[model samples]
Target chain A: MSTTTRMTGRRIVAIAAVALFILHQDFWFWESTALVFGFLPIGLAYHALYSILAAGLWAAAVKFAWPDHIERFAEAGEPEGGESSGGSVRS
Target chain B: MTPMVIVLCYLALLLGLGIASNRFFRGTSRDFFVASQSIGSFMLLMAVFGTTMTAFALVGSTGKAYVRGIGVYGLMASASGLIHAAVFFLIGIRLWSFGKRYGYVSQIQFFRDRFGSSRFGYFLFPILVGLVIPYLLIGVLGAGKVISPISEGRVPPWLAGLVVCAVVLVYIFAGGSRGATWANTFQTLVFMVMGVVAFSLIASKLGGLQAATQQTDPAYLSRAVQNVEIQTREGTLIREVGVPPLMFLTYFFVPLSVGMFPHLFQHWLTAKSARSFKLMVIAHPICIMIVWVPCVLIGVWATGVKEIPPLAEAEAGKVLAMMVNLLVHDEFVTGLLTAGILAAIMSSLDSQFLCLGTIFTNDIVLHVAGRERFSDRQIVWIARGFIIAIVAVTYVISLVAPKNIFDLAVWCFSGFASLFPLVFAALYWKRATVWGAYASVASAMLVWFYFFHLSEYGHEYALWGGVMPVTFCFLAGAGAMVLVSLLTRPPSPAAIEKFFPQQLEIDQ
Candidate 1:
């Protein structure tokens, strides 16, 4: 992917992940009486699914939103004086 | 073996571990405070995970789930899983880079440098310490609550609190952050394994998952409370068992506290490289699930267990231990499970204690009194002195000012969460000014104090009836940052260039 396209894709993913987090806080499952497999409450089960989805979203974030400067810094290895190169892009 | 003996043996093992780590200590202030920035990814993951999962996750959550029902999981656990990892990815990585660049060992140092105001540490140092003391109390109180019941009156609660405080102090004092990290990694494994074991055993003993759910009130299964009559000492009392929706929604802000914790800042600095944070970010939510789901399930099960009596608010913290004793006939299993609970509690206490000491030694003593005067050995000793003093103060407070572990933790996290806007803005917003940072701190503290005072009268009290105090404090802090910075001049271009170079380049 082109640099700009990848950056835009990351921005879109970041916004979507944040929106998903906000929507997760709403009380949609609060009144649901359904139970998952007849044991877990619908609310409890909803959060369990949410936790899985969150894990996936965070993995995506690591792949995309991760700052390229950090990747370059890691590749360059620790600087001689232990100072981070100030010229790198900000995260 | 007796539970007290088991606990004593565990403490002995911890002391041995602390003493052993001392041999590996490099005898430098850097090694003591930031572990020489030598920690690998796996150890970093364990240290971060262990520190975050405190007594609040195990004992308090179980007790809370018993009273509030399954909604307890949603209140903090599920949201925390995602929010903590997100914070780690966004805030932690950036801070690690800065700390690596600037050699910052504490949050105070970071703020002082970022805002170009040494005196800013004066305002921040007190608020961070004041907030951490209550957080320290949560661990001490939780240790007492777990040990007191399992020991069945043989060990006094004060003695339990003292033992935990002393054990944690020895390791942290002897070996510093390296010792704390080693201990936390070990304890993390112990508690995670035993948490699942205890959960599985209790569920099966109660006659399987389906049978357990059949016994619970249907209303308790959902977010809405089931009004149930409990047999108290005087008479039957009606109690609400479940969580309120709005209060639950607002708890989303509480987990954001991880972003602003000074101890976590110190931990982030200890990372060998930025990549070390990847293991922490990816596995943090999974680790939260591993530890929390069992505790929440056990807590919800406690509500329906016919053998266990309905618990009053004060006694509810003991629900985890009560379930262990009531269901498991094996004394050995009970002791091991209790050790697991204590493991979780002590893991956090050691880090908080050490972080506060680091702050005092580096930010206050070295920075204010001048670093040239004190030798590196003297600096380490100064930090050890502060750790001992803080532990003693917290132990005494735990005995006198007893509160529920979960409630105290929430209030503590709210204080940190309220300050999140300051850190977030300082890192991300190039226009954030020193005055704005001050306003954010002042506004957050003022709003937090008002709600904290109100909570003392009524535990259920919320700002404007529904919103949690954290929501208001976070907004007020963030709003003050934007408004004050816009009204005032932006930070100096040089300062912005130093921190946000890429943004400055774009602006030009």
Candidate 2:
């Protein structure tokens, strides 16, 4: 992932998340008595698909929005002058 | 008899898993409370997701869907899918980083350190435990209600509640949260698979999913509440009712409560690496869909099923169990479905029992008595004793628990959602102060109680003009935190440097 693409992906995912939230209300389907696949209500089906999109968006968040700096802090061991590692025995 | 045996076996398996996991226990408070921080991505997802779900996901959602229609899914599941992940990504990772960095065991520790006030822990501890007791009752009471009907009354609700509590305590006592996570992982998988199987068999029995749904009134299937005018003896009136749009929109805040759940914070700390959060962040929404869509659908379908009895307002929680019993008559499958329901309930119970114990031992007992006074072994014992006491108290209350599981859960969740603002600001806003946090909590509690006192819990309760109390409680909390934080002197720079370092983009 190039830096520009990574940044763009993050922006796109954020926009998509906001769109998903807005679409979630589904007021149009609120009164419609339609069924999809003859088994699921149109409203219910819309939300199920919305849930999948959300999962995808969160995956995008992990890929793009993950804070490597914070991870580096942990991997780099305790910072100098940090409090004495509290009272814990890490395996 | 067969179904009852299966439920017993299910409980036994959980107990066995916990006892077996205890063999790996390191005999230290760290290991007992947080699995020595060794959990990886898959187990982290299971534990976090499992704890987030409770009787609320299965029995309560099903029950609520029965009364409220398919909108129940919209009101909670879909919004929860988005909001919960947002919180996990935005808050969970940051908290995990802080917990690992500071070796913090409980949420109170993080808040206490962030605000530089030990008094905050004392304030926050009782509220967290107070709210969690109702959460625990949701499971215990849900279990009692769930098991009796599914087993044809061979096992009464009180006995079922006892067995469920006993089993959870046994596993929690032996395994601590580490054991609880392992058991949660197993139980989570069990419930998910069982949820699908039950949904399939019951739908197959009731003609088909679409056919079962279409059999009900269109009004039941519709999520819209529209205006209808009527004439009375004295006057004419217009009414707009069903599911209020404002109520639906405000429900979006209820799931935000997860960001502040103490048990979830404990699970977050268990992550072995920051990367472990990646899988959890991705899979949680999909997992929620898999569990909720069917349960809600089954609940709606129960309305059309001819064999099922009419569930009164108070008897709503029993609707799911009644469907399983009346429709899936094969004893063996009923047993499995019952185990699945119990799985969802108990997975959450073990974690809650373990978490409350963690809070009492680490936050209250040790902080006040001084860690210097007790050995690590003694601390673990103190935790165990306190956990057993809480479990007994929660179970006794479950005996006379209210009729509607969903309503009870909503009230409990509203209380936690009130604290969501305080935790959010503490993590993200460096300016948040100790006194600001105090005001935020005070206002949040006052507003939450103001609304709660107004509610009879007799009908589905909402605030002015059909909005949920959570929306107001959350606002009051956030408004107070930001206003007071600005007015008060800012946090010590040292606190800022500790929580935020080098302008990390995530923090920014």
Candidate 3:
């Protein structure tokens, strides 16, 4: 893969690992089968992964719901120096 | 010197540092406010963490844990910390990347740039400033209340608070974020050390971590799996507060959205690079866990130890002070720990003061005055003046405000929640019309005022179990964004390309 893609991939992995560490308890879950199924519905899984997944779903919903609008907004040209094109231009 | 003397001396040293840091101020308005965008990731990271762990966490969280049990400790302290980390991951990195690339300077700028709405900036500005004033006042009053008893009432709580605010304003006004960044690092380190020492002392007194934790009531430890009934003072069963574990998965998004808070956005904006931003985000969950769990556990332990008075009888923000007094009778250590708590309070208050002042100067004042560029010297002075003014206003409010910290905090969040959805839509949805944004903010605030704030109707949304109003506010904003944008002529292609270049491929 290209350098930019590789960087992006690394970022995703790093983010995922950090998310897991934050939400999930390695010590709590590694030994306890009861925890895995018990917390799944509440998405607690007592793990950071649950928290990360919830957030990811919310963000994805937002992105998917407004793909067209997002594209249009992105296509909006850059504001000229000292001029705001999005609204009334200030002198 | 005695503990009080030590604390006073620490306060003086902080003031001196604030004054010293002022030398770095480059006489620019932006420099005085945001340090002219010179802050790097480390400073930004420290500032983010330091500014967020407010008086509430220091005192109220402990008090809550003391009263409610370990479940309160986990929910208020650990959950908040973990959720905060979640926010950083989902939104913080993107906000930082966008702000740096777009030259976004203020929360208003972000809302405006993302939504292309001058009106949205104008609308949200007042609401932000309004919410921020009470929020800052809580910090001041909270610190003051804690310090007063510690000083044997020698330094009145209000005066102690005023002094802390004055010292913060001095450094913040002079050095801007530059001063806040370095000062916050020291402040955070002090808090971390004091926290660990205090936690260890408390844990040991309770017969070590495992023993103490095991002693906690089963219900307190079971919030993850159990649903408990909440009761009113009259013994009436209030509606259940906790959703099922499955429902909590969805409800978890509420606090996590705090990453979208304006102050958090500013931290993201100041990071040196996207990598630095990511590192900070990744590190946050660990940092939060280390600090929060011990405090919550301490709170849970306090509940079993003795009979603390009910909430009304006790000073609202003195729970930590009581715990410290009970645990550590050593005068010097007490003073140092008191100073550490003060550091946490001041660090949070200072960053907020800077943020509020900057928003007023950059978003409201500049917009209202219809002038953007002035000499850097004038801007710096004006910005400082705004800081002083904001502090004074908040002081008066805190002095006279009738409600307790929790009530006030909820109110503050209500104000921001009204506006948060609009900004969220603007970023993610291209069709988010300015009119829709305005309507959502206006209607939500209006509903909040009438139902939650104003005339006491028996049927209030916040008090009652109606999720509909909040859900409606969120949906109304999103709906307005879609319906209005679709109905109106699409933004000019040049404007679209300028405002949102990533969307250019849609032309095909």
**Number of the top-ranking candidate, with DockQ as the measure:** 2
What would the per-residue lDDT of candidate 3 be over residues B1-508, giving only the tens digit for each residue?
3778888898777777777877876665545555655676677667788877776556665655554443343343445545675456545655544454555557777767655657678778777776677778778887777678777888887788788887887778667877877688778777777877888876676667666655544343334333344333445432222222332232333353364466666656556554454445545555555555566656655544553333321342455566667766677878887887888888778878878777776676665666445554665666678888988888877777654554466455545555556656655555666666676677667765654544242222332332323444445555655676677766556545544465322222
- What are the per-residue Cα lDDT tens digits for candidate 2 across B474-504? 9999999999999999988887887777745
Native-vs-model 3 lDDT? Answer: 0.58
Indicate the DockQ of the complex predicted as candidate 1. Answer: 0.31
Over 4 Å off, model 3: A1-88, B73-83, B86-90, B224-253, B256-260, B307-317, B370-373, B454-473, B503-508
Cα deviation of B278, candidate 2, in Å = 1.1
Find the 10 residues in a row with the least total lDDT in model 2 chain B. Answer: B226-235
Give the Å shift of residue B249 in candidate 1.
Answer: 2.1
Docking level of model 1: acceptable
Better of 1 and 3 by lDDT: 1
True contacts kept of each: 0.32, 0.48, 0.02
Backbone clash numbers for all candidates listed: 0, 1, 27
Worst 10 residues of 1 chain B by lDDT: B499-508
Candidate 2 has a DockQ of: 0.40
Report lDDT per candidate. Answer: 0.82, 0.82, 0.58
